[model samples]
Target: MAEPSKSSSPAEQPRWQSGTGLAVGMSLGTALGLTVLDNLAVGLSLGVAVGLGLDALQARGSSTAPPQAAPTTPGAV
Candidate 1:
């Protein structure tokens, strides 16, 4: 006869996953923070470039004047 395999509980799996997730999140956060600190000038320049590019795209069709309102009759007061 074969013996039954040991299976982990569902709750235990989630707890292990949660611990791994926290470690990964902390590592990523630390790397990103160190990157920003190490290259503040480049980051600022890139941010400004992106901001200006977005602004330009947003302003593409705004320079044209809007249509004028139609003339109203005097009796409409």
Candidate 2:
């Protein structure tokens, strides 16, 4: 039998994944906070927040995409 395709599985791919931006952001943020900021709580919180923010930004354009055309009504502006 042929082996399963690694690309189809998320766990197999090791490169920086677009879906993992939040995780990456959080880790980086936490690292920054712990070493430079010298605050565990702040570091963890900021890391999580940054991670969430990155996720949101990346997902912003995916769902609820902007309308292609402006309002058709004339003199409505």
Best by TM-score: 2
Among the numbered candidates, top lDDT falls to 2
Candidate 2 has an lDDT of: 0.67
Worst 10 residues of 2 by lDDT: 1-10
Model 2, span 4-70: residue lDDT tens: 4323233444456555867887788789888999987888888888887876775564444553443
Give Cα-based local distance difference scores for all models: 0.47, 0.67
Runs off by more than 4 Å, candidate 2: 1-19, 64-77
lDDT of 1: 0.47
| C-alpha RMSD by candidate, in order | 24.5, 12.7
Q: Which stretches of candidate 1 lie over 4 Å from their true place?
A: 1-37, 61-77
For residues 41-64, write the lDDT of model 1, one tens digit per residue.
Answer: 555555555555554443442333
How much does candidate 1 score in TM-score? Answer: 0.33
